[model samples]
Target: MTDFVEVDTAAGRVRGRWRPTTGTGRMPRSAAFLGIPFAEAPVGPLRFQAPVPKAPWEGVRDALEFAATAQRGDPGVTLIPEPSVPGESTLNVNVFTPDPDAAGLPVLVWIHGGGYFAGSPASAWYDGRNFNRDGVVTVSISYRLGFDGFGWIEDAPSNRGIRDWLLALEWVQQNIAAFGGDPSRVTIAGQSAGGGAVLTLLGMEKAQHLFHGVYAISGALADVSAERAEKFGRGLAAAGGVAPTVAGFSSLDEERVIALQKKATELGPSSLGSIVEEGLPLGPSVDGDLLVRPTRESLRAGVGADKPLVMGATDDEFTMAFSGVAKKLRWVPKAFLLNRLGMPKGAMRPYLAANQDALERGTAGIAGRLLTDRMFRTAVLNIAEDRGDAPTWLYRFSWPSGTFGFAEHCLDVPFFFDCLDGPAMVPLAGPNPPQALADQVHAAATSFIETGDPGWPVHEGDRGVVRVWDTPVSDVVDGYASVRALREPVS
Candidate 1:
């Protein structure tokens, strides 16, 4: 029993700590709450705009420390690392709890991936303490990455890091009910660009209702657009020698435009690389004021958030980013197999005649099943066959990491943040007792954040029931039919 509290938030009266652990066969009593801002501090004229509301503070503040970011590549440069813990209101939020009054529980939040450029939610594999001992509250957010979060500064304001994650889910819908949580039962998970920012905040419309459900691991909603994120912000303003106008690039030198975005991600897969499928040199777009469109045309016009969604991907999402540039590059295996299959000439031959033994793992298992079925199993089967009144759920972690290679790409994020016994979950899920697939993907992600039903069912089509996971718990079916027959569509 260790207590420390302070509420009244919306950006103030902060301070927190509240334990109750008493279940220490190893660890428990959760209820933590480190570093709680939510926005504000883009520094000097709110560099590149969008997230505003973080101003009120007047006392109590503490929040035990966890703030200071955004110099993390572009927007005045620096590429992550130099902040053992600096401060200046880095748009924070970190909560974990068992019962601050534990009302209606079920709130997840999360959202930390690094391809929008670098990561942090005070990373320690995102400590949400075994997801608040499984009753659930667990939040973790902190936006603004590269080019102060997804550069694209021409007329400015494109995915300002997906509008700082929709104002941190509108500050978890007006303050996650004083930390007991249940803001209408939210659930917005992430991984790998925070699983494509949880499928671009489930096709946001200001992330309607803040969030009702969604898991989106692995992430994809392809090539974001808004005129190709303003032509990748005019190629990141011609790699920082400016004049691409955000008023001639806000007086340049945000670490020399993130050291020219680490010299355009070391000039490898340019369009200013570091993954650019749907435009924008940084990430996230459609940008009619913070991603209000394109998530494959809002999941084929069904518009998002029908609710209860869960999603999956890993089965090698690009073998640890092409085994970290395969011994320092050389590529050209036919232009790295046609720019990693953006397709050309022989249109990759129906994905090479449906995997003729995946060309000897050269295309790292067909570029990890075409980057996990075009960025996450066809946008989770197009938001699970376009909402038949929601209830999506889909899986395919296909667990293959006895220390590297299948449960790849941010591997089920420390097995649903139970800290898969951290140390980076043994090169992705191995090295001594991961206690049965981290207690079954943290009990199916806390039983779908406590009762959205994650035991598996809704994914109708080819009867593929998925829940597979490891250490035994079957129900498989469509387990990569040659990566969903190379994601069909080739008429």
Candidate 2:
């Protein structure tokens, strides 16, 4: 017989399973209630609409298994073992708690990353047992992905995926207490696109009540404009032979739309240039209603000034992706490639000079570094500066992957989760990642979630003091000085 733990939620009773702690989590075992629906699946009438709360259920629902995810297949974007589950009802949340009956425990709400188009919450790397053991109830959530979630339809709403996130947080606020989580002590965190989601949420006035703090890891901000979003939507519809309306999209098969989205959003001749110039084809946009203005603008206006934030990116996120071109483009002038990547002529020399270490790696390495710096590192600095001393902490994951030789994207996730022993760690973090670094990173994360500070120096007035997460983790001054060229007008 399966031994199940039952917890009564606002809508219904759920039966979850208990597993012994995998690594060195303090608790012996923690309960995981997977696939608890927070909203009706965005199908039929709900397609492309704001999430509607799940209706109350009659009997105890078994949450022993993971739920369906909007991401339908292995897209290789997340770099983790993110599985795609199939079903019409895909709007759900998975809860991992130390004790559903306990009172007033802190909560960590996680969002996953996949460039706003692909990613799944159902990844082993995200299981929250370690957090649960440490007294932080953890929740990983799912949202609509790609064109279906972000594509503009005249009759339907925009930013459906964004809406899904809002509704999921609302669910946490209302029901997390039933799972032994304190409603007031919730902190939202995520990597990549998910990191961007938390930042977006942090800047939302409507979302200020949902979570108390944020920790964004290598966030890839979308901030797509309304005009661009509409254009992408029209292009997607043209590719699918459908109208840019609810009726046309609803008539098409979900699988067909999925296929069309990729073709429609494929990168052009200059992949890096396209990403930097056009930005993601689908993601949270300035809808003038829910989103109001852009995320940075919202932050600048002090929309969510009260909440604490901790954010950073790996030193070489995705730089390794361009390593293969190192030899082929060895002789290529770094300035020429930066020009091709759409960096202004005025900015090329200065940008290249600022990133000298990357410059030494030849063309491919330099290009990759520019891509990471432009897309992620610069964004971090911008957000931190825009935030204007609102209780912020910054850090850089500087430890190169044991296998990849670069810090790389997704490398710090297992460390953040304190799950270096997790099944997916080796592929990204290599065979023997330093357990001590994981201890430091995870400890900081747990500390921040619990006390609203990551136990490091706070980012004040662009001092550039940042925690360098490598061997003998230590604080440094102006740690991000290398990327300063992109921050200012270089002529």
Candidate 3:
């Protein structure tokens, strides 16, 4: 057994376990400090409010296991595979470092993605051991999810989950040097909702100077307007038979609050069949304080212009959303398309002209392409284009999974973390996934964290360059133009 190592943080001293690197023979072992609290427990009076810094403890606290995670559904019920480790102290952070005494190491703070509803840092796929082996310190954080995190509540702080992330970053800035990480060399990254959080943070005035760079993988950028957010909050409050305030939510049992939140989400209009899908039900709110405007607007106005950014999405991001009956539905109704996407007159001609092969495959294939372009591809492109003076690098995860088929959403996560062998990734990566690709991806990410460049040309000029991750990684120019043109008129 490896020896136990202890590190002192602002809150207290904690002991962590040392584990050797397994797959990569060249890397060294790492020290893992799990379930370290970055904030006070968000229960009781603290429930719906923004996170407060964790109080200092008297003795050495054990950081051996993961802290309780934000509440989520049973693994069996959800399509996404996630860990369900329950506890009161859900606002926690886990750290993996090569040496607690080493100085000047780059740090990567990872925010987990779960559609702004479900996900935890405890999941095996987020292990940072490999990053430690690569001479970087990796920190994975957990924040409030579902209603507790993003549900709009009257009298409660807006974007509480995002606030939690900011606190965690602050903790890292103040304490990471003890673990051999340079506080100034921090890079904040996440996938899916976490990716959205990174974008949201980039636009947040308070988040400036917290991190040097940003990496958003399969990052989603969708939020409701204030009016819509307030309506959703009121609806959830009614579902729970309580006032739409922190006082009412704090009085209810946590489980009841979760159940009512789910009920409220389900009662909303379905995104599956609708042409004009409702924006994400629970996510960062466009509150005047935390977010002055939409994320795209904020970026266009020079938010995070000084921070280098690396962002990308899989080629088939929305295909995973179609399953069971939805998969069989295939094509979206023509009327729904005309009304929902606001396709201009004669738009179909060009879309079909550009995507004849998808049309031949049936509605499902076409719907998948449209959904991907609408939901993720276009949003990412818009963010990239609006990033102003920020040096940006873009990528596309084009390696299709054997089991899931196509380059599905989140397939690149395990590859980026170099955790393809993780059990939670089996269904997504299939067996015998390529390690060579993982090596390249991880190397590039580490390079970005260590330096500002990701070894790709900066995204500028009319035809921006993008690195495509596939069996044979290559670069593509102006790849988004076709899809952007097809969706622009309608968008």
Candidate 4:
């Protein structure tokens, strides 16, 4: 344990220790600076608007420990991964580098995904060991989640969470030089909602020049529409027995607002509840400020970011999320299924026509795939199409996990980060681990970040080639037809 020294930041000097780990065959040296403040406390007056920069402190502040994270997946809410720990001042970023004084190493800034409701940068899966070893300084950031970040209140800023993310990037631009990272060669990457946020940032004018490349894994570029966000605000107000205005909302306790958010999730897509509404709501809104417009529109218009992009989704993207829902919905009576699914009373005939002996299994599988594909695979393809001018490296994570074949949603994080090769691989990939597959994916990602190529052809008009990442590398085209069909109507 090297003794921590005070490092000057835009916000004053903070102390951080350097911990050196044994270098792997490829990773010659690695050092991590645990918790560095990227932004000031998002408490008191700075609770709702865009994040304000931390004021320069008078003396050295400790940056040795990880700060508390935003609230995520409390017991009453859904079962998504929550922050291991929670608190108010969750706006912080952690950095890892091979050399603290190495002038201008390429930077890889990561944003974690937890449905925009859960997840934290502190998750073991997000550890930046591999990136640091590969000669790229890595940084992971934490932002607000759930109601604290996403809840809509009139006269208050919307998508405060995404704004928090932008603030972290701005912090990186200003301070990464001290840690030997090149602010000029920054690459932004994210998983799930983080991936979605990555795409959103790419299209925002204010976020231009902040990054030179992007890596989005299993994220939907097209977020909920603005009209839907207003409906969600109404729903939350109804749950709390208050109006949706900022004044009416500020009177309610944090717990009360959180309770309404939980209720919104439970009601789900059909009931116009919250984030998962049937239409569009509960996501980064086109609030005309933080999120200037929809991601699809922003990309199509070619607003600002023109950097190289590496974007992809897992093969079984929706299975993990849908499995939980299918377990409960499978038991519903067939007569009730029609009404619940919004199909006519005699709609079972078309269902039977489409699926013969395994109607239930087929329907569940199709629905699950469609859900994940629309939210991830299709949206990514749409982004690629609009980003025709930008160098694009497309991929499909196809290594089937023995535990959950084809590797369900969010499974690629550990693999690409090189964190799943050891003991932790079993729980996620099962007893008969696919080490060969893991190695292939890891190499492809590292290569893309280091160089410009990911060993796959760039996606062109009709030639939509994607890197089929598995035990061995191969090229495939337009394999996600079902997902394409589902989202074609909207696109």
- Candidate with more favorable, higher TM-score: 1 or 3: 3
Candidate 1's error at 385, in angstroms?
29
- What tens digits encode model 2's per-residue C-alpha lDDT throughout 331-384? 877677777876664777777777887777678777888888888998888999
Candidate 1 on 288-325: residue-level lDDT in tens? 66566666567657667466777877666655556555
lDDT for 80 in candidate 3 is: 42
Best by lDDT: 2
lDDT of 3 by residue, 354-456 (tens): 6554455455555666677666777777888888657999888889788766778788998898887777566777777899999999999999999988898
Clashes per candidate, residues 3 or more apart or on different chains: 14, 0, 3, 1
Per-model TM-score on C-alpha atoms? 0.35, 0.97, 0.93, 0.86
Worst 10 residues of 1 by lDDT: 73-82
Ranking by TM-score: 2, 3, 4, 1
TM-score of 3: 0.93
Q: What is the lDDT of residue 142 in candidate 1?
A: 83
Pitting candidate 2 against candidate 4, the one with the higher TM-score is 2
How many clashes show up in model 4? 1
Candidate 4 regions with alpha-carbon error over 4 angstroms: 1-6, 20-27, 72-82, 267-280, 322-363, 421-425, 481-491
Best by TM-score: 2
lDDT of each: 0.67, 0.88, 0.81, 0.69
Model 4 scores worst on lDDT over the 10 consecutive residues at 272-281
